[model samples]
Target: MNKKKWMRKGIALALSAVITAGIAVPPATAEANTGRIIGAIIGGAAAADEMNKQIKYYNTTEEGRQALFQELQEKYGVYYRWDLNSQLDRIFTNLTAAIGSMDATVYDRPYNYFINQQEGFNAFCTLGHNMSVNVGLYSYLSNEDEIAVVLAHEMGHGQKDHPAKGMKRSLGPTILANATGTVLGAIAANIWNGQGLTKPMEWEADNLAFEYISRSPYNPGATAAVWQRVIDLSGNNSANAFDIMSGAADHPSNSSRRDNYAKKLTEMSGGKVTVDDGDVYVNKKRLLTPAPAGGMSSAERAYFVMGNLAAAYRNGHAASAAYADGRTVMLGAQPIISCTDGDTSAAEIAALLNQIK
Candidate 1:
C-alpha cells in the first residue's frame, strides 16, 4: 500500500466513515492521573499507553475484534474496505503465529491482522499489540509483495516486545535515585502517551518484518520499496520526524532507519546488496540512491534524535547528553539552536519541544 495506506492502517478505526466512534482509550484514575489531555505532552503519552493496552484487550478475542471490525466497516462504509485481502490475512496470520511462538512472548493471534473498513490510506500497530490496516491500503499498494512488507513490519513490533517491554520508566527520577542512593529517589514519571508504537520500535518492527517475510514467498526487492513509500508519504515530516515511541524510551529516527537497512542488507547479503536505486525500491518505484531499501533520510533522522536529546537533557535525564548529539550537531551549526539554551529542566525542554511545530 502507499504511505497514506500505512497511515490509515496505523490508525485503522478512527478514519472509517462507517464507524462513528471517538478516539477513546480507557481513562486513568485521579491518583495515577498525570493531568494532560490526549495528544498533549503529559496527557498524550499516558493516553498512548492506555490506548495500546485497552485496544489490545478490545481486539484480543475473535468475537471482540470481529465485532469491532464489523462496527468499523459499517460505520466507515464500503469506501474503506481495502484491508479485506485474504492473501494479507493469510500472510499476517502465518507470520504472527511463527513469531508468537517465542517462550517469553505473549501473542494474541486474533489481533494479528487489523483491518478497518475505511478507505483511508493507513495502518499501524499500537504498543499494546494491536494491528490495524485500513481498506484504503490496497489502493496505495502495488502488489502482494509490497503489502507483505508492511505486514512484516507490524509483526516486528511484537517480536521486539515493544508492546510489552516498552520505554523505560523515567531517566530523570531514576538518575536522581541512583545519584542520591535512596535519598530523593523516585521513578521518573512517564511523560508522553500515545497508543501507537515509537518510531524506533516501528523501525525495529519493519526490520523484523523484512527478515521474517524475506523467508516467505514475498519478493525481496519489494522490501526496500516499503521504506521508500514511507519516506515518500512522510513528506517534509521525514520518515522518522515524528514521535514513534509509546510514551517511553527512545527510538531511531527515519534517517537512522534508512542507514540501518542499508547496513543490514549489506550484512545480511554478505555485501551483495548495495544502497543503490536499482537495489532498493519504494511503493513499487525504484530508489534513486538505493535509499537503503528499507531506510529513512538523514535530515529526518536528525530531527528525532535532536528532539529527543533536547527533551531528555531538559528533563534532567542522566544520559541525555550522550544521546543529545543530534541536538548538539544542530547547536554546533552557525545559527546555534542549543538544547541547553531552551531550558535546564528536562520536563521544560520536553514541553518546549512539544510546542514546536
Candidate 2:
C-alpha cells in the first residue's frame, strides 16, 4: 500500500508475533520512547483505534477496575484510610446523591473515591468512576461546600466519559492502549492529568458542578469563590505552580472558570453581567478594569476581577467600601487584584469596584 499504511501493517504483524510468542513488553517501554519508529510503538492512529477498543473491552472486567486502583496506589501510595476517609466519605456521598438525583444510571458502576497523600491541590476522575482527591485539597480550602464543588467538577468529568475522550486527545492511543497487566491503570495513572482535559471539557465540568451545587444544599457561589480564594491566595500571578487544580498552563484559567460562575450567580439573582473583550459590564455598568498584559492576559484578568466582585457581593464581602492597600485593591479586607508596571493602578480598580453599591 502506501508508505504509512505499509509501515502500520508491518508493525501490526510484529505485535501479533510478540503477543503470540508471549514475550513480555514492559509497560513503560513505549512510554519512555518518543515513538519515532513505526514498529517500536503501537502502530500510530490505526493503533490508537485498536487501543480504544481494547480499553472498552477491558473496562468491563474486574481486573480493569482493580488494576487502575493498584496503579494509582503504586504511584501515589495507598489511600490515607484515616480521618480524611470519613470526611471524603461525606463529600462523596453528598455529591453522589446530588448527581444521582438527576441521573441515577450514573451510579450503575458507582464511584469509588479515596484520599492520596499528595501535597498538590488537585483531584481527578478516571475510567470506571474511580477517583482520588489529594490531601493537599484540605490545606487550601476548608469550606465543605467549596470542596464539594471541586469533587463535583471531577464527577462531571466521569459522567461525561471524559477520561476516554481526553486520553485520545492527550496521548492518541500510543503505547498506553496496548500495555499489559492492566492497561487501564497505565491509562488512568498517566492520562487524566490536570492538563489532559480540553478547555471546553473544563468549562463543561465547571457548568455541571454549578448545576449540581445549585440543586443541593451546598452554596452554588463557591463555584466562583473557590477561584477567587485561589487568586487571592496567589497574588501577582494568575496561575500557581503548586496548585494543580487550576494552575496548569493547559487548564482553563481560574479567572475564566470563576467568571462563569459569577455570571450564573448574577442570572440566578435576576441581574446582568456581560463581557466584551477584556471589559466587564455589571447591570449594564462597565466596571472592573483589567490588569495590563504581562503575566495573565487582560482577558483572563478581567474575568478574575468580575469573579471577585461576584463573590464579594454574593457572600457579603463587599459591605465595606473598596480601598487600595499598597499595590493591591481590597473589597473591605479581602484582596481583589494587584497592580504592576504599565497596569491599571489598584486604587483605580478599587474606585471601579466602589461604584457597585
Candidate 3:
C-alpha cells in the first residue's frame, strides 16, 4: 500500500479501537465496586513495595548506577556537576535540606539529583528517585522560592511513587480483563479506567509538593505564581472545542491549576482568595472574565451542557432525558465548532460528546 493509504488505514484502525472501547459496559454492582476498591488498596500497597525494592536494587549496584548515569547522559545530554560552591549547588543543597526536613523517609531514599544544560523550563523525576532540572528552569525562576516549587513538584513524583502507580494503573486492568477472555471488556477496562486517573495524579502530585513547600521557609504562593507564569507564557486562546477536549484528557488547564494553588495559598494565609480580574479559562476554554457575574460564553456553555448530558446518558440515564436536557440548555446557544446543526441523530451526537469526555 502507498504511504497515504497506510496512514489512512492506521487512523481508521485507531478510531475503530476507540469506538469499540467506548461502548459502555454495564455498571458494576455495589458489591463489585466495593471489592474493586479493596483490591485497588491492596494492589497499591504491593505496587509501592515493588517500586521501593526496584529502586533499592538499582541504587545498590555500581553497574546499575553507571548504567543509569550513562543513559541520562546519552539520552538527555545531562551533565553531573559536583561543584559544592556553585550558586546552583548551594540552592539545590538548601532545597534538599528543606525537603528532607519535611519528609525524612523520602530524604533517606536513594535519591539522585542532576542539572541539565537544556534551555527550557523543565524538570522531571524518574521511577528510581532520579531527578533532573534544566538550566532554563533556574534562569526563568524569579526567586529561590520558585526554584523550590519546581524541585518540590519533581520530588513529589518520586515521593508519591507516581511513575510506578501510573504503570500499574495503565497495565493492570487491561491485563486482568484480557485474561478473562473478553476483548471488548479489556478495551473498555483500559479506556474507562485510565481515562479519569491522570489528571487526579497531577493534582495529587501538586498537593504533595505544596505540603512539602508549605513546611519550609519558601513561600507557598510560589506554586500559584509558577502556574500563572505558565499561563502567561503559553499565549493560548483556549476558547475553542479542541483545547477544551485536550485539557480534559491530560493535565487540568493551567488556569484551573493556578486557581487551585491560589486557593491553597489563601487558606495558608487565612484569608479569602482573590481571583485575578482577568480572563479565566476552564477546561482550557476562556470562559469567564472579571469576578462580578462573569460567566461562560454561549458556545462554551452549550458545549459543556452537551458534554454533561452525554455523561448522564453514559451513567445510565434515559436517552430521552439526556436529549431533553441537551436541547433545553443548548438549543438557544451558539453551536460549538465541532458540534453543528445537521442531519446527525441524537445518538450520533451523544457518541461524539462522550468521546470528548
Candidate 4:
C-alpha cells in the first residue's frame, strides 16, 4: 500500500488558507458560545501540548504538509494563468528575500506558492510555507508594491504559525488531538465557516507585514495606501471574501488599519515623513495639496502620492532635484506623482520634493 494507506493520519492541521481568507470567522458571540466547550476540551496544559504536537507534525513532516496541501487544492481548484502566476512568483521571490533580512527562519523551509482560481481578493500562507493567492487579487490591485504588501501579510501569518494556532483555538485542542485522519479530513472539508485567527492575531500579522515590506524595494507607504484604496473602492462594510480591509470581526477596521500603517510609516522614517489632516508632510513642509483623482478622494489620493514619494526614496531615485514632466512630478528620470486639480501645481510640488529630497 502507498504511504497514504499504510499510515494513519489526522487532519489535525489544514490551516492557513481558511483562516487568512476572511471568508468567515466565528463572531465574538459565537466564540463566546463555544468558549466553554473549547476551554473544557483544551483541559489546560495537556491540550496545549497536544495542539503544539500536531502543529509540529503538520508543519514539519512531509506527509502532514502534503495532506494539508492536497486538502487546499481539492477545496479551491487551481487556475493556470501564466501572467498572474509569473507576477506572483516575482513578488514571492522578493518577499522571501525581504523576510530573510529580519526572520532567518524563513530560510529553514522556503515558501512554495501557487495561484488559486478562487475569484476573490484573498490569499493564505499555510503551515510549512505553502501558500496560494487568488486570481482576483490582480484584478483588484494593480500596483506591484501594494500587491507585495498583501503577499507579505500572508507570509506574516506563516512566519508566526498563526494557522495551526488559530485552528486549535477555534476548533478546541482536544477535538483535533483525538480525531482520526479520516474524521479530521471530514472536519477540514467544512472548516471554512468557523476557523481563523483572533482579532489580535490579525493585527500582529499586519504589523509584521509592514516590517517585511519596509525591507523590500517596495515602499512601506504602500502598507497604508493599500487600505486607503480599499476603502475608496469597497467602503468600510465590504463583505467580500478574504477582503481583509473590511470591518469584520476577524480584522481591524479599514480606517484603523490605514491609520496604524501610517503610524508605522512615520516611525520607520524616524519621523521624517508624516501624514497630518489630509496631506503628507516631509521635513515638516507640505509636499502637496491633494485633490480627488481617479476613483479616490483627495485624502485617499494623498496617501497614494505619499507612497510614490516613499518608493522614490526607498528605491534611491530621489537623489536629484525634482522637475515637472507635463502634469507629473519627477525626480531625475523617476516619475514621483501626477498633479491633480484642486491640488498644488505639479511645478510647486516638484519644488517641494526637491527641498525634501
- TM-score of every candidate: 0.47, 0.61, 0.49, 0.74
For residues 1-357, what per-residue lDDT tens digits would candidate 3 score against the true structure?
A: 985455434333322332222213333453244334324333343433433343344344555444554555454566455551254565556666766787776655656666766665566554356666666665555456656777777677667776445534543554433222232233334322322237777787778777776666555556765655555555333332222112224667767866677666545433412334443222233322321111223322222332232223333432232221342222113221232243244444444433332
Over 59-91, each residue of candidate 1 has an lDDT whose tens digit, in order, gives 355654566555544544433233456666777
Q: Model 2: per-residue lDDT, tens digit, 220-300?
A: 656776776676666535455544444234676667777778778677534645556667666677765466453345655
Residue-level lDDT of model 4, residues 226-335, one tens digit each, is 88878777776445444542222566677888899887766655566677767888878877668776655677667666666666665567677789988988877667
Instruction: Give candidate 2 regions above 4 Å deviation.
Output: 1-30, 33-42, 57-62, 79-82, 173-192, 236-239, 247-250, 272-357
Model 3 sits at a Cα RMSD from the real structure of 21.6
The residue ranges of model 1 lying beyond 4 angstroms of the native Cα positions read 1-84, 97-108, 112-114, 127-129, 159-196, 233-236, 239-255, 277-357
Model number with the top lDDT:
4
lDDT of 3 at 318: 24
Give all candidate RMSDs, comma-separated. 20.4, 10.6, 21.6, 6.2
- Pairs that collide in candidate 3 are none
Which ten-residue region of model 3 has the weakest summed lDDT? 239-248
Give the TM-score (vs. native) of candidate 2.
Answer: 0.61
Query: Could you tell which candidate, 1 or 4, scores higher by TM-score?
Result: 4
Ten-residue region with minimum lDDT total, candidate 4: 5-14
Q: Is candidate 1 or candidate 4 better by lDDT?
A: 4
lDDT of each: 0.41, 0.62, 0.46, 0.66
